[model samples]
Target: MRSNHSCTVSSAPYANITCIIHDDCILPCSFRPTGTVVIHWYKQQIPVHSYYYNKDQFGLQNKHFSGRTCLFNSHIPHGNASLLLRRVKVQDRGRYKCYTSTRKGNQEIFINLEVKALIQSVNMEMTDETVTCSSHNIYPIPQVTWATDPPTAQGALENQTTIKTTDHKGLFTVESTLKILDNLSNHTYFCSFISADKTQVWTASWKNQEDITQEEGHALSISCIAPRGLQNFSLTWTFTSSSEPTVISRYDSRTRHTFNLWEGQAEPNQDLLLLGDGSLLLHKPDSEEHSGTYTCTFSGLQSRHIVQTKVNITVASISVDERSVQRSWWSTAASAAFVLLTVIVALPQCVRQRAVETSTASHRCNGAGQRWTDGLSAV
Candidate 1:
């Protein structure tokens, strides 16, 4: 006789299961414990997985679920008949039926499965005053958005180019590029990739720090701080003064070495760059050649970019003494010009006043002389 013929079985009318692509998942089912157990999992009457005679039976299993479905054998006696699916695929999304039979009775449950291929990484890089954000192999077409830390005008986001392409596997690749105008350097920019269902979101950020001013023959250091706890990461620094960007150096933690691409562009200290914080140290930097924008990118596994930091370096060509001398010369010239203008304006008014005074004096002398002559005539 069975151990529990009167054991009760319970299950929900409907169950929902969500799984990520290239990952494992489980479809749940519940029943009463009994010595004799029989379970069969199906996708719309298509045989997925079956268990009977205290063992798994796959002779009639579907080809799509071959070697990918299994029931919890150890938990069978305890009334758990859940099916474990490995390396889920997009086609495995639909309603499934889990049928269980024990000595007590028989039970069945309906389950709905959803498969999603989430975005693995987002890459953001700046070239020629334009930043581009891109991602690949995403299912269910994602949405892209750009934002600034200080919240810039909407025109900044509107003036971008975004493209989405579908690969042969029906996966989407999205790329968006935004022009970094001079006015936007004060604000940090962020790009986000969001799934249509809003279940998965990946974002990356970039910021351009204030320009670093250095003398002509001074040693310059560009600091790039990445997030903590990165394994097998890569550090790439690029220099751009004009339209094109040149790769300065590249350091990979796995290789434990630095690869200098352009010699004269930037000479990164091998020891200091890959040491703790990954900051670039230039021994002696030239004023004209080294004055440009330096961008550092940190990439994790599979070359997926994590974050970016940009530094602007300005090499002052003029010395402090030269500036002071220029200021003094301008001051002296302005003072002399002011005095000349004052003399020119006052001399005209003085000449006009003198002429009026002379005319009045001559008229007074004539009147006095005429009055005396008239008195003599009267005498």
Candidate 2:
């Protein structure tokens, strides 16, 4: 039997470190001059574990890292010694160095592990009934989870999640859906994901709705925000009434866009009461006629925004006081005198006859009446 001489070689340096939730990450390392070698994994300049020759062992493994770290391949005959980290965490975000030892010499490679927390983007549908939150550009698939701040004793559910992996980019994305209740005005919810390394990444709380208020007899103006700078966009406004709600005015800038509503049709005079602003002005508002649901829609290359506002007509009432009563009485008396004068002027023949009768009666009763009586006796 030929005695086998075991030659030991050092492991290659590790590079391109990455971590994802629940998914396995490979820290790549390689060496030349293939031979029997031992590979060791170190975190932050401390020897935590070792593996080689098809045997699994720990050199100075940290209790917290036990059963969580492994080598891609322990057998070093072919000069391949890579570390596999499962379920990465924020604490695991640090420098990692791989060392290999062989009869030829000692070889080592340094790698930096960077862990990124999950990022969330929220959007709403045209109807504003459904809101979708999506997390993109995440590496190493992770276990995604969601919860509401206020725990539901009845287990009231408001969130759902889905995961998708792209073979081309070798990246994973998570999408979540939240159903808003009627009373959920500006209610906030959070989405979180945990990596296999027991690291937690959380996103900012998201609100599914916005609040808007407009005074009675005043036009309502609304605006939408777009990611990045404003480019080409489409806008539309819809009202609940039979009459089409005129788009009183609109403006688009490199940053944002706005739309306004006016009382009458969108004519020249009905344009923006102020230039370059999205505010609208109502001419004469009848709450019952103009108050209802109004929606502003904006669509761009990257995102879409829909804003809805309810117009409530605030009707003001005037009370009848002493001053008003006196004013009204004077107005009525003036109107009655004007009517009598008009009637007398319109009946010219009747007015003249009444005057003549009165004058003749007075003449007969006076001294001239005695002369007329004597003349009548003579006749």
Candidate 3:
């Protein structure tokens, strides 16, 4: 190895790449090579992969990289020696070296790789009144299970999964869905994912989702949640009945902004407001104003990322009697009762006067009869 005195010292090629753990990642190394040469991929000092004399040499490769590392041989003819790594583990993080050598000289590139875990938000959908929990953009397939506080989630319910490429990078994206046969109304079902070693990665639970119907001039409540590890996201409540949904409230975790009624009526709900699991509480809702197809959208901080759940809030109007509107029931009943009492008191006085008059007439008749009989006897 020799350094040309005339050649100016250049900065070491530095590449910082982020990848989801348990997904495939590529350590980039690009250059225009004319002929076949020796390619060496090393993690720090350990030999990850090596290609020599137009063939792979695994004898010198590290045991950890036995089957996980490969080189794009097709690209090597055009001078690309990027190593394709599969199922990136936590220990794979650190600096890597991609060295290529020809008959006379050698070239090198340095790479800094990072592995991260993304806990996607879980969405529960009710179709024909059946609850289905689903999530997307998950990395390195984790074990998804459905559970409950009481009458725990049985193992009988099966889960469905799918895998796909996430980006230009070799990382993978997974989608999972769980269908619940047991009733979710009375019990709080927990849908979560765990690491290979049984560590709690994320969880979602619901128990208090009672009937949300309300009469006019009453309160209404609805709630939603994301995974446990997720912290930064946007929560928006939109009324979807209109041509274009109108945003009722929006809370952005990145900017810490609370727009609209997020903190309008009741301030205590703010605790549950900014959290991963958000709630909507309309302290006083009018039947005509607040009823419609409502949607809660949870968008990730990244671009073009969102999870949505729909809720049909029914606020029915109640009919009122026109007579009741004129006067209160209690007030009208009191007035009628007072009038009846006065009639009863006046009737007793009239009856007593009539009785006295009849008694006087009877006494006068008896006196007249007695006087007539005495005059006849004297004659």
Candidate 4:
């Protein structure tokens, strides 16, 4: 004999089910020590308006769940009371309960049903040819649909004709291929997912790339290319020093097409330019102040793209005094010439002094010889 208190459901407390329109979802609930018993299904606390027992007998179920609810099996002996809900609806959101009653008593299990309202899939691919959009994740997979703004009715539409879905790790993913129809224009596309209870949408965008380049210590022209047809879009150019790359200069521009650097100029005619290619040009490039990364961003339609490029200014050192080095060289040469002249003047005086000493010694020798001669005669 099995005790009513010990019999319990084995599945987790919440339901982990998702589905799209025209899809089927299974709510699995298993119990212990099961036998043949009368099984019933309910939404919230109310019984289902219609149901089937043992695959043959049918009965009244809830009005909301009519034609959509089914039992996997009613025989509790087999331990299967799983429910299958088909053609789910937004109103299907609520708690569902399954009950099994035997001659002894009744046992129950509960499931929380959630109906997703939006099913969105997003895919992004960057290539030289086009930007492709794809679906990332969808539960209870639905038929994918694609839409775009500035309608693709013109020959400008170049998207791949087919959209495909792939399943990985029990989740469904889809993708759409879109090619660049116009290089000068910006385009946006939407991918949507449809289900009985939920609907989701995602957007992908592309724009023409813009850039600028220039030298230091001069005025530079910076322009950003806006999508060819967009009239209300705004563009701005910002200038910053290289030492603290985040420090903005006063010469930054509020409009994309024109930039004036009267304030951030290190010298006259020196300014920074923002170009359509998202490149920065310094009028007079100063290696000390203009060497670092410059970032450009375009914001519109609740989306933005940020591109950063490094501006390296090669500075040539300018000599302040042109004659200083030449003067030092001439001074060293003059000192060497003075030392040579002193050596030349003292060498002749040293030679003359040696000759005078030799002459005095010779005179002394002659005097000694005469004295000896006189001594001999006296003797």
Candidate 5:
């Protein structure tokens, strides 16, 4: 009962469809609505899905596509034959053939599906002289690269170690670590995760701490400001004095709570305040305990930041000693000047008295000489 007239079957203008792995995707194909529709989907020559007799037919469907393929049945009457593919896999990337037949004629169209799982987040952390970069839940295994702000020599990165692993779903997890034998100050380290196809790349950077001076016994506010409008974020504040780094405080935006890990060294609830800018506030930091490196890491779903701040606590006793030394020097100089002024004033008065005495003695000697001369003349 079918006519020889060719049906108006049109292919998607965009033959390429990129879908995220583990997500649903649609392969588009349509034709003019004329008569009862019969559709069969194929990859190369392999049967993927079928529909006929006004219902879905799966007796001859491909094992790879079982329970994972469906057509827009409700919209089929409107000439929409788009196939919905569920839980896309990397192996599902290929040219798909959508063959449709009706009372008018039969036509087919080809659509290419590309599946990819992109790199989510690149996180970096530094502990002492070692820096680490990591990422997880990625498809098409990624490569890791390291660089420095000042452009370190190739030999400096010779000790870098990299590792890659796959999870149950065949997604990739990558990590790279490098020991910064070079000076850890004033240099910024960069890490990148690049997809195998080179289409997706995520980069994370960290700068070694420069000094932030805080005087002893002062209430200090170590800034670890998170990004604005960020949700489901976690903030961690850590301190490092010797070889080991210790967690001092933690805040999770999801829980809307802050945890102080410093125990006896740090005040509990009274020491922490969530500032408007998301900075951490600490009260009366102890010079001996808190005088070290403070690292604040803010991690969110889409972004990550690692900030290292060096807090050099100037000892209160040392400052007091310096002031005492300055005051002693000033007092000694003032007393010496007063004694010299007294000596100078007495010298002038003594000189005037001695001169008056010498003038009187000279007049008496002249009178005696005249009396002797008159006595000699009378004799």
Candidate 6:
């Protein structure tokens, strides 16, 4: 006799089986049998899988589970009558029963198969300034929940979810967004996607990146690539100092150009805007004032989202290179003077020598006799 079948819980399920959609699910219902016993798995009194006489008895199996159902026959000797269900779907979420007929009597094992939708990959975007998190590629209905290290932030944020069914597969693609009314940092946003069976929560974290260092008077150009694709963004490129942040440039499509420090002066190519890149042609730090922190802030496009990237600018002087540039400039000026002197001093001497050679040739021809001068005098 099977001890597991001693006290049967036929009214409710013995256990709940949770699994993701399109993945394999195991409906566990096992009792140590004597030898070969009859096994029947049912859903709502309908036959899903049946096995008897030491083989899979699928003649009476339901057509809906054809080629998609299997019994763990290798474990038949050990009485592990777990049924493996393949390629789960939303319709597979239901209560099921397992009937095992033995020499002692008939045993009933019940199970609740709960299949949930899943997102294989989640793309999360976080903005710490406003505490907003956004992501797509989710499934079913999604909700956003706020969580902190100490669990202080709860019910303080709001959730916004949107879902659309895919064209060919008909699977749901959910977009979950959250906004924290009170802005703070060092927090994480959780996006919970719930289906009929289970709830999966994904987290979006807020953390700063590494700082940057550069030599003074060298060109600096960095890609201000934001993870979020804001339709229209109000970007502010700022250089931070000990006192306050000075605006290098601020622009948006609507505002055009709010303020640009390098607008009139040539150098650093003012054409390369802050939104594009903060570039200064032949730019150098005047003093320690230029060396501080810098950041590009993007806002307004996303209603509750504020994205910012900080760059700690350490402007170090290139002493050797600076002296070399000075020396190179003076050397170039001296070389230009030497070339001009060579041309000026050598030109008049060559002209005077050519005039003397012509006079000498004329005297030699006059002294050559009347015979030689006859043809020349007539000409």
Winner by lDDT: 1
Worst 10 residues of 6 by lDDT: 300-309
Runs with alpha carbons beyond 4 Å of true place in candidate 1: 1-11, 127-130, 168-170, 179-187, 195-200, 207-216, 221-281, 286-293, 298-379
**Backbone clashes in model 4:** 44
Write candidate 5's Cα lDDT for 177-272 as tens digits: 999875654577778788888987676767765677777787776665444455676777788898699888877766777778875445323233
Query: Which regions of candidate 5 are displaced past 4 Å?
Result: 1-14, 150-161, 184-186, 195-201, 210-216, 219-281, 287-293, 299-302, 309-379
- Write down the lDDT that model 5 would get: 0.79
TM-score of each: 0.59, 0.37, 0.43, 0.34, 0.63, 0.46
RMSD in angstroms between candidate 5 and the native structure over all alpha carbons: 17.7
* Candidate 4 Cα errors over 4 Å, as ranges: 1-123, 140-155, 161-163, 182-198, 216-379
Tens-digit per-residue lDDT, 1-379, candidate 4:
8555434333346665654434667776665434445667778777762223445234555566667777664344567767788876655667877776554556667777765534443435545566555554455455545445556664555455545554533445555565665552344444444543433333334333333344456555343333333333333344456344342322223443434453444311223233324334445656676665554444444233333344555555435564677678789999999999998999899889888888888899999999999999999
lDDT of 6: 0.60
Compared with the true structure, all predictions reach lDDT values of 0.79, 0.57, 0.65, 0.52, 0.79, 0.60
Best-to-worst lDDT order: 1, 5, 3, 6, 2, 4
- Poorest stretch of ten by lDDT in candidate 5: 267-276
Model 3, span 1-379: residue lDDT tens:
7653222322256889977777898888865465667888888999999998898899988888889988888778888888999988767888998887764357778999877667555655544333455555554456666666566435644544433446544334444544545454455455666644454356555443444566655566666655455667777776654567787788888888887853454222567756676667777666556666555656553311223334344555435775566568668888888898988998899899899998999999999999999999999
| Superposed model 6: Cα runs more than 4 Å off | 1-14, 20-24, 30-38, 52-54, 72-82, 100-109, 117-121, 125-142, 146-161, 164-172, 177-201, 206-213, 216-339, 342-346, 349-379
The TM-score leader among the candidates is 5
TM-score of 6: 0.46
> Tens digit of lDDT per residue, candidate 6, span 1-379?
6363333433334788877777898998877577558889999878999888788888888887888899888887888888899998767778899888766556788888776565454445555434334443333455545554335535565344444545334355655555544443543334443433344444433333344566655555533433243445455666667777777776674556566775542133345443444333325443364555555555442222222344444546457889899899989999999999998999999899999999999888777876677878888
**What does candidate 1's lDDT look like per residue over 12-36, in tens digits?**
6888898887899998987877678
Better of 1 and 5 by lDDT: 1
Which residue pairs clash within candidate 3? none
Q: Go through the candidates in order and give the clash count of each.
A: 0, 15, 0, 44, 0, 2
